[model samples]
Target: MSTIEKALAKQKTKAPATNDVVTEEKNTESNESVSVNPAPAPTEKFDIFIDNEKLTERGFLHTGGNTTNQQEEFRHIKRKLINNAFGPASKTLNNSNLIMVSSANPNEGKTFVSINLALSIALEQDKTVLLIDADVLRPSIHRELEFENSTGLLDYLCGDTDDVSQIIYSTNLNNLKIMPAGKAHHLTNELLASDRMATLSKELSSRYPDRLVIFDCPPLLGVTETPVLASLVGQAAVVVEESKTKLETIKRATSSLNEDLAIGFVLNKTIKTSKDVYGYYGYGYGRKR
Candidate 1:
């Protein structure tokens, strides 16, 4: 087990047992006492808006709700990721919770996978998730989530916002939050590769060790910024469109990533053939060790 898991196990084992007799006495007294009702606490609201129809149409698991097939597939995928993040394998990772999702080229469904993976991880009882729109050149996460464009990672890195928390927006899904890609800038690549970005990355990983931070980055082979961001994250998942993306492209794209980072490939939009008894279009994972 990892140190974190061992500690949690130990804590659970050492927890105090409930006192049944004391609870019975308190309940007996409460039954004889007068009852007074209290007002309910106000629900926390977020400024962002989510279009359910759009989200459903895009195959995203509904926020704070449930789905069938897609949700199950992502749950299986996220399980392996979480194990790599916090299990015995995580010892070599600098910030195991910080993960980036990208593809070799555009329209490979990287953003779609990124958002789904984040949502699935958020469904876990013990962890929270922060989905960051890292594709500054053509940010699509806000558009995917149906939220208006706002300040985010770039704004904080460029000194436009001193506090990073200001850029993070909470969602109706209690455990999920988002960091939108801020307004477009000419020097977006330079800003992402800057020392400021490195500091912010460290701060994010350390501040909330239990939070899973998923970055929806640009395509690897064609984009300069994705590689830079990949180097900072401890783990990365490359989304490859099955039967469409070439083996050479996958190799070339993954070559840019840091060798120390744990790399995995997600075969997306796979179509079932006559050889397969079950016909389903979904994603599958393969680890690159």
Candidate 2:
């Protein structure tokens, strides 16, 4: 069983700590008839087309998708940084649809941040969010959300599937959907840069004006894909590991982006205390250090 199904099954027996999947069956025993409720199987299963080869399996995105609390923390940072970076770029830019979560290199929490951001937006009572795993070369959102990777953005882009919506997996998060990346293609770069991607973006944006689309892209320095993706996303956020990201590397990454793309930096794994929350700088809380 997929992680979501497992979680749902657990939820059926108890309150889920995060997303809840509830199933109810009504039954009546009579001399001549019996009644019961039907349970629909949760979404599970996936496939991949690698170098013109096809493969299939259960979902991956929802498998280990981040929880709601982690999402909330990301939301806090996203809200704060948008005000700091994009606020002045364009008053209307705050109303952007595309958001790219990236970093100088790998292992800096970019994927975690991006997925959580999408989850955060989806959790919003008034918003609809779609988290697209655009990192085709090494896509992880599929695994995170316990989503089946059989057919997805790559499938749609390659014309393997005509109905793009078929691959969109509805999640426990209300109003939230996911479009994961499929197998690596021979022309991955061309597909990402194609007009088809732009058209898909436009349609998705137009359909859900209040929707937020978060693209979990590859590390800017490690792959050409990120800069290419940056060209498409309206804004980008960089997650810097505390005491690790070099200022020079950050500059190089930022320099590659178009100035029109709003850039914001977040210090992750930051050390803080209660005083820090009370207008006091540094790691101390209310107590003086």
Candidate 3:
């Protein structure tokens, strides 16, 4: 063969090899473009605005309450409950972080204590608080907090919504969260006693070791669900109204609670004079054998 013919043939073969290399690079770029994904959207907040000024005016604890003696009183009260939940006492108790605040009868300030206690705990450096208004029959968390009522615990228990995140709401009060009692239902008491509620309780207690979950429950005397709920929590704070709560009634109410629970009696409305702080006085209770 001639030299020119040999050079042309060699050049033609090299051109095809170069084209094949360019084609392979183009294919790689196309696959990468198809695989690349867009960034995700930010999640919206499920939130509630707690009225701190109203809460403070009503003699409750919160950031707005400032350095009042009432704050000092609750600090003393929550200190023991904190010890029971996260301190040394937590070792011996099942789900010590789960606490229930209830009363012998209605209108005894259980909800007041529940909100204040939640506010008190939310102030902790390392702890968070979720307040669940479990009193479905007569929901008050919304009324007291001055927020419009909405679906929550009942909606979840009724299978209206399966997601727990949908029910729990963040508050403006920093580290404090809440789940309202939700719209009242006919089978409310039955729902509280269901196996699903039990499972939910297990998840709430076990999921967060640094979070304290408080349930503002119905009165023990008239309600059947309180005892079922009492069985779930490790601690109970029974509010007894000063002068109005009869001794025998207190006996009957306390008798219904589970013995294994670490119980505490909160003396409510102890204000003898206008000058007094007139806050709750909590005393520990132990079952008598």
Q: Highest lDDT among the candidates is held by which one? A: 3
**lDDT tens digits, residues 146-196, model 1?**
777777878877889775556777664546778899988989989999998
Of the two candidates 1 and 3, the one with more favorable TM-score, higher being better, is 3
Q: What order do you get sorting by TM-score, best first?
A: 3, 1, 2
Give candidate 1 regions above 4 Å deviation: 1-46, 51-53, 63-67, 272-289
Clashing residue pairs, backbone N/CA/C < 3 A, model 1:
none
Tens digits of lDDT, candidate 3, 158-248 = 9998766667766655467788888778998789989888888887787677789999999998778899888889999999899899988
| Candidate 2 Cα errors over 4 Å, as ranges | 1-72, 80-95, 271-289
User: After superposing candidate 3, which stretches have Cα over 4 Å from the reference?
Assistant: 1-45, 277-280
Model 1, residue 262: C-alpha shift (Å): 0.7
Q: Predict model 3's lDDT versus the native.
A: 0.75
User: For each candidate, what TM-score against the reference?
Assistant: 0.78, 0.68, 0.80
Pairs that clash in candidate 3: none
| Whole-model alpha-carbon lDDT for candidate 2 | 0.58
